[model samples]
Target: MADATVRPESRWYGPLAATPRHLFVPRWWSPGERDGTWVYELRDGASDPDAWMSCAYDKSLSVITRVGPHHADHAASAAVVPEAWPTSSATLPALVVKLYQHAFLADDSRLLVTCGSGYGTALACRRLGDGRVTSVDVDPYLIQSARDRLAAAGHRPQLEICDVTGALPGVYDRIVSTVSVQGIPASWLAALAPGGRMVTALSGTGLLIVADKTADGGATGQVAPEPAAFMGTRHGDDYPPAPDHADLWATARKADGESVTTGRYPVMRVNSTWDVRSTLELTVPGIEHRMESGADGTRTAYMLHPDGSWARATAPGARQVPTVHQGGPRRLWDELDRIRTWLVIDGDLPVAGAAVRIDPDGTCHLSRSGWSASIGAQ
Candidate 1:
């Protein structure tokens, strides 16, 4: 995984190679489906040694440790649980390096990093020494488990059970998070030492914020050139249940919209297109998406918002312009088409490489190419 993720000359390469990733993740969850419902099939490293090494060493695959309230370590052998949001994971090695690289850690930098399965923390401890690293998690079980595994691996970083969005344990020169946040937390700004740096990704978007502490207590930086994502932070065993959208879904499927017309572009699975999805999310936050396909090569897509707005589009074949239906106070489909049109006119979206200015209160301001957006604290 180290060779595949970073060059041998890189400072991170040795740490990545030396850290025992499998020791931190002895069991994990793999997604599957049963009778049309999503489920999580547990994978135990002890049950299959070869599979364990392969998965642990995979540079691009995140090992899911907790799904909803069910943790892999305490699960029955070969147990399959119903699918829900993933609560914790040992992040993919390559992505962990990306986050660390964004931080630009120095030999003497005191680091505070988010801990899930402790693998990334182990890597940091190896590179910077255990005394300089501190790891925090909201789940007590995860913190305790990581403490034990990290000790067995011959590294003992300070592991604390605390929410990433709350008050931190101490001031640090660097703060890096493997989990996503809706916005910068005010507590983080308070915990960062003078001239400190922070690296984190925003929830529901691919934007990676990297900023250096300013004399005035705010930070200034820019969005990273590359896009990355991680599971959102959770304050409890599981995230609150997603908003109930049953009636909105039914309306999107059958009810005629306030406006119906031919779409300017072909039907798209918006969620999979990172740039488009990220821009749309910045423009119109909190929109849920769904898609379906028929046996005859027909495809349909739906977008629902919390304000009773919805959009539906259907295309007879790939690359075909879709017929669009939109309802409620806002034209959701038109908004999407406008963003797509902007992407076509310009070479790329402005969110990438945008300048970021974070206030002391954790409000984020991003601007690029005359376009600007702001994300206040959630």
Candidate 2:
């Protein structure tokens, strides 16, 4: 009954109905904490199945398995949730079936998938036998738990703890990743068998890209039918802090070189997809955006680039205009204005059609309709 709402009704539903949800989740975690109270704790699933099943079947929710790599084995019945971030989770079933069906897995094809809470891997294994399935995760504990869960219900696929960011254990006919990646790693390209298909979600956007491995260095494909968000692969327990906003702003505002503009758009959110992210990324190139709201009543946004191109826009509260300053060969504001101009002329921009050319050094150029933007590692 729970799996029916997800999609592409699974033969695995009987097995899913058989296994108790409490055994897998044992606990849950929210994005940040619930109030000041941390909800990262294991909720003593040994005593309660209804509560766990309700959470498990929540179509839009992700059930946290481990918080900061803290497993549920040693925690007490009424343990307080940990404040650390979520490391592994059982993704919502809807997304699970979405990615799988996108891969277009053939009856005979071998599949490789990332095992987080293992719920996803189990679904695939159920569709295709254990011999055709392989699941990998960076956490040993997750791999072990998934192994037990799968075996208990009479399934055995390759369960390895290798990181998804590196070389896979074996060549696969198709690879489906539930984790978003910063970029398509060359290792994945190398590990992929000829003519095989791989589906992945890019790191920064909700877009899910489905591509096939080609003879050349690149893969050719299009975005998937639906959107998905996967936690990116982490080499370590935590990520390096993002660049400081205030410091970048002060530096950009102080620099003197290129021309400056007074006003056009008010302080806009950078991540907004409408026309903002495109314009800013186009105009600013490699520069990053920073936003700050101070207790003294000031809102500022800073754009910084490795090329020393920078811009700062500051405004007073909700009303009024933002003062702008920038430096470098390019006037960052002028570039943004140009992109906005393009958006107004044409209703929408093409992302996949955004001409993507990669250099030997791995730098990427995104050019569309005469406007070009470059992306590279920091």
Candidate 3:
């Protein structure tokens, strides 16, 4: 995992190699389908040592530690939790390194990072010493478990049970979050030392922001050239149930829209494409997407927003244009087509390398090529 995650001479190499990731994650959840319904199948490392080593060291795989409110360690033998969001995980090593790399840590830089299974915090401790690293998580269980595990691994960093968006424990020169946030939290601005850097991804988008604290108690940076995403931070056991979209789904699936037209682009799985998804998320905030492909070569895509807007588009095949139907106060499909058109003409979306200016109040302003969007406190 170390070799796959970082170069031998990289500053993170020694720390990554020295830390035992498997210790941080003794039990994890794996997704599987049971009787046609999604479920999280528990996997105990002690029960299967070989599989444990393989999975724990896999550079690209994130070991889910807690699913909704069901923690794998406390689950019954061969437990399977009904499908729900993952609450915590030992994030993929490569991605963790990427977040660290974005921070540009100095030799003595005080580091504050989001802790889940504590693997990332261990790596930070190994690299910068336990005294220089502080990790926070909202789950009290996670904090206690991680603290015990870190001590067993011969490292003890300050582990706090606190929401990342709330008051932080101390000022730090480098702040990095494995969990995504909707916007730069004002508390983060207040906790960062002058000229400190922050690296985090926006929730629901693949845009990573790397900002340096400014004199005005805000931040200035840019959307990373490469896209990355992480689960959003939660204050409680699980995220508030995803917005109820049952009625909107029905409207998108069955209702003929107020306007119908042949779409200029093929039906796109907007949720799957990072660049396109990021751009649309910036422009149309709370939209949800669903897609299906018929066995007979027909593809259909649906878009629904909390504002009572819905769009359905159907195409004969992957490369064919789609017939679009949109209903509501706004034309959802047209907005998607417009963004696709911009991509076709510009060869890239503006969100990729957009300039990010965050206000002291946590209002994030993103702009590039005359396109600008603001994400304020929710």
Candidate 4:
């Protein structure tokens, strides 16, 4: 290990500087290894500390420690090498601190946290003592690996092999989820001691929820100022194939009987940002968007969901007329059009601090900036 650039003299700088990132992320992967059966490799930085320090401090990169629910141990040795999409990582230290700050962890508070690489759990132990943290993960491999890592470092945090999105085992003053959730699990609320706070991200968006547990088997909260990313909840190692592509193409690019429109917003990049994606997901509900570019010059974007809702747009050139087709009781394009209209009139649909209400059955209600919607069971 080498000297770190994350400053120790600064307030949050202590953990960044003190924690050894190189240990957390000894290896990573890239796109080329998508087909390879084996991935992962060891870092050769014992000979070059400066190179290691640079990677340790990079805010944009996450140290990949686990993949496809397979931790580094059971995963192939060289398979951890830089190749396919990084399935899981020890999120950068600064982001972890920010999430902890959002959680408002106090010395007296016991926390139930989701474990991935054990980096976050270590930080919580450093902040609130090892006994005050309970970490859970769905994969036994992850929990076991994290436990070994913590034990080797002389830290004994509570580690459990449990599904984070389902029933959590312990009660705590606060719950901080480093994983995104599809819904606010009722079990989490049940595990929270009365008035406990939870800081978590909504699956598929950059939305950070800050809610306090209520007595009536429900919770209420608004959005947070900072945006964070966490691996989405998983039932199995990988997510089931999102609605079949053939079915998407079938309803999305229909032959006849639909209205068309020249969209007002010309080809906005709705793919990257969380705010835009979350808004679209809320307004458009179940529709899934697809973007394509032809070999020649045509480009198309399609939205298809299980509700028989479909919307498609074809553009020959940027800023040109985009032929659109739509179907379903809730015209998906019209909803996008409404969002665009709201953007034009008010500049943006309020996302953060959008009122969230959860019932005993785990249904979520999202309302903000005058648009209200509900999400039922998956």
The TM-scores, one per candidate, come to: 0.99, 0.75, 0.98, 0.84
Which parts of model 1 have CA positions greater than 4 angstroms off?
none
What is the C-alpha RMSD, rounded to one decimal, of candidate 1?
0.9
Clashes per model (N, Cα, C within 3 A): 0, 1, 0, 14
Give the Cα-based TM-score of candidate 1 against the true structure: 0.99
Model 2 alpha-carbon drift over 4 Å, by segment: 1-22, 32-51, 67-85, 240-246, 249-263, 272-341, 352-378
Across residues 1-378, which tens digit of lDDT does each residue of candidate 2 receive? 355644335554554555444556666554446666646656655467677777877757788766665666656565666476566788877677677777888888889998987777777777787899999988777788888877765678989988787768998888898877766666666667887777876665555667776667556566554656677777765455555556555667676546556646666556655245644543454567667786877777776776666777777764656777777555666566555666667865554345454332323445566766554521
RMSD of each: 0.9, 4.8, 1.1, 3.9
lDDT of 2: 0.67
In candidate 2 the C-alpha lDDT for residue 51 amounts to 74
**Total clashes for model 4:** 14
Residue range 13-99, candidate 3, lDDT tens digits: 998898999999899999999998989999999999999999999999999999999998899999998999898999999989888
Model 1: which residue pairs collide? none
Q: What range of 10 consecutive residues in model 1 has the weakest lDDT sum?
A: 269-278
The true-versus-predicted C-alpha distance at residue 54 of model 2, in Å, is 3.1
Which number leads on lDDT? 1
Q: By how many angstroms RMSD does model 4 differ from the true structure? A: 3.9
Worst 10 residues of 2 by lDDT: 355-364
